[model samples]
Target chain A: MVTYIWVFFVIVGSFFTIFTGNVEALNNEILKGGADGLKLLSEMLPLLVLWTGIMQVAEDSKILELFSNLVRPFLCKLFPSLPKNHPALGYIASNICANALGLGSAATPFGLKAMECLQEDNPCKDTATEAMITFLVLNTGGVTIVPTTVIALRLMHGSANPSEIIITSILATLCSNVSGLIYDYFKRRKKHG
Target chain B: MANFLVPIFVLGIILYAFKQKVNIYESFLVGAKDGLVTTFKIAPAVIAMVFATNIFLNSHFLDFVFSYFTPFLEAVGIPNSILPMAMVRPISGTASLAIMSNIFELYGPDSFVGRLASNLQGCTDTTIYVLALYFSSIKVTKTKHALSAGLFADFVGIVAAFIITFLFFG
Candidate 1:
């Protein structure tokens, strides 16, 4: 799946730019791609490190277990295949909590940890499990409540009420999450049937 | 609120951990080491995805495709200027952010388009990027329905953003 997407990007992007008479920019991006990736990594690593460290404390102290226990009912419904208090559940809860707060990058470490825990139970190393897919659906659906980045940007741009769209953002995010979950549910049913 | 959430959350975790008699500093170092290892582990995948995505974005393919649909979209109250942001959103967050900033610059952040862009930014995550990163990190080559489901959610999010924006700000 990733193979096809990368190929499509390279082939289509190069051809389109060349045909559009902007080969220069495409050349620049291709060359700068790796550096940009590194720059992004450097920027992201700090938060991931900090959160992973902090969450590690949370995990070690069994704080995560307590937290996950609180949310187990809701998470169990979303991830029915997993045991009642799977280790991944705590990480999943942490990831969801971080994500919902709009600490977008800060959420990645917990999410990565969640994936690692989920992978432990994955029978086939190279294939995604249903639980993994469901978790990804929840993660990528962006169930943000504050939209700190957007609000901050608006604040920078001198808006009268930068956070006014908080309600609207929440509504839209709810729609996305609900819709994604519904789609995932249907696909799960079909696979079983 | 986000400003305070981090400190409060961190304090809560620390307090809990301390009460639990956990070796906080040692555990933190161990986890931080794991974080570093994991960061480097995924660096290659990050580079690969970023390379392809940057190429795609720099090509301005969405601009070309959206140009053809601008008239129709604008006729329905969707600003042509915001199309690139919406299209690039699920693909690349920074690209959408750049476009959103441009929109704010061009037509003040208080405008309907600006509000719509704000909603759009909040409504969906970068589905393609997140999918690639997560699955590739685990070396999962066969992602059956993750892509479709994530993109489906993004599509719904975009539409919802439009409706919610119009309802609230328009």
Candidate 2:
């Protein structure tokens, strides 16, 4: 799926640029594209390292166990396919908690771990399960509470009220999450019913 | 308020680790090393995403497409400047962030456009990127309903961002 999209972008973009007589600019952009990837990697590297380390501590200290236990009931309701005390639920809870706190980089490892756990139980190795899809929906909806990065960017850009968007962000994310979950619920029902 | 969250979180982790008799330093190193490996694992996908997204964005196709919607957006109280950000947001996080920071620099963060940009940025994760990374990590090539559902969420999030921004900051 991503393969098709990736190819579409490169092929269609190049063709469009050629037709628009921006072929030279497109040439420059294609080169810059790879460099931009490296730039992004550099930017994400430190944050990923720091958060994963902290998350590792949380895991070792059983902090994740505590956190997951706190959210387990709710997660069980959301992911009924999984067993009540499944390890994936713990990872999923940790992922959601990290996302809520706006620790996106920290959330990735937990999410990946959750996926790995889900895969362990998946009968079909190549296909995603209903539980996996539901988790993806929730993860993509994001449901961030603080939006720390946005606030920080605003502050850096000299906004008079850097955190003003926080409330709106939370509200908007809630709306997205609700709508996404509702959609997923109905779709799942249709599949089973 | 947002500033204290990370510090407090770290402190909480440290205190909890101490009480649990966990060697925080060793655990952290182990996790950090895993993180570096994860980074490498995802680097190829990330690079491909960035490269392709940049090519598409640089093609200015979105700009061309959005030009037609400018007047309608303005009429609906949405700023024309943010359309591109909203469009590419689900595809690439860094691209949207760059657009958002540009909006911040140009209009200042207190402006309506700025607030909308911030809300858009916060409302969702990069759906395509997340799907690619997570699925690839597990080697799940058949994504089933995940992509459609994730994009649906992003669509709703974008609309919610626009509407909520207007209600709050318009």
Candidate 3:
């Protein structure tokens, strides 16, 4: 239902731009965009491998368990139904950690795993549960500390001070996460009531 | 040379020390394989979207839109130089990155608009990519509400990045 509206919006937006004479510029943009995309894909490959390897090692070492224990008190407040030793909890922690470091590419598997684990415990057959909703909010507004992808882009672009945005990124993410959590809390209350 | 070599040597020693009896090499290979698989799964959508965004920007439509958006963006403390990147960001991360780099090169990194643009890049996701990948992976055939909400979230991120930078840095 809602998806239709979204598609409409994208179509309209694209058409609107095209009508405004941008469509004529498509050939150049396509070539440049392809080159840029390929470059990014290439640069990201090695870093992706490194981080994925590290995450696997972390999993093998039960380091995620230690990290989960460290974050438990805070996570409990956010996800009360999530048991401390639950597989979902560990995955959630790893996802949050990876997100915080701005390694979203690294976070995807953990996010998927968390969702899978949560679904296993879901009593409802179809709809997403309260925990799932909360997880979605958290992931959507996940606090980023390093903003690595942005930094990489900046560096690629020739920024003299690529790292300077770090402070602003931290503050903005903090605010968004706090507000998003508040929104989730109020929305959940309405749903339950 | 020493500055670079020292860190490499230290990292090598650490890796060696941390090496366990387990077949770490095989495990790493498996993980890499999985990552490649995910990348491949996303390849088509990513490529098409990237091409589309490139066309949009190159076609001068972006310039036309930016002219109208200039005053509004200025009100939010985003200079004209940063507008293109901000507009492209929601559609494509890599492209926005290219624009960010261009701005950094032109204005120098410490300039207000340059910093703000870079910050906005960090703060937001490629909204379309998120929608395409996550929902598709879950077999979500419908995404109307999610799309609206996600785009709204991105709008908030962009505005917030600008305002926060203005308040703090400007």
- Highest TM-score scorer: 1
Candidate 2 per-residue lDDT over residues B1-170, each given as its tens digit: 65677799899999999998998999999989977887787788778888888888888888888999989988987667798999888987778999999998888899889999999999999888889888877778888778888888888898999889889878
The digit string of per-residue lDDT tens for model 1 on A43-140 reads: 98887888889999999998889999999999999999999979999999988988999988988898899999999999999999999999999999
- For all predicted structures, in order, the TM-scores are 0.98, 0.91, 0.73
Stretches of candidate 2 exceeding 4 Å from the true structure: B75-77
Interface RMSD for all numbered candidates? 0.9, 2.1, 5.0
A best-first ranking of the candidates according to their TM-score comes to 1, 2, 3
Question: What lDDT score is found at residue A98 in candidate 3?
Answer: 68
Q: Among all windows of ten consecutive residues in candidate 3 chain B, which has the lowest summed lDDT?
A: B1-10
Best by DockQ: 1
Candidate 3 Cα deviation (angstroms), residue A94 = 2.2
- Cα lDDT tens digits, model 1, B119-167, are 9999999998898898888889999999999999999999999988888
Candidate 1 falls in which docking quality class?
high
Worst 10 residues of 1 chain A by lDDT: A43-52
* DockQ per candidate, 2 decimals: 0.84, 0.69, 0.32
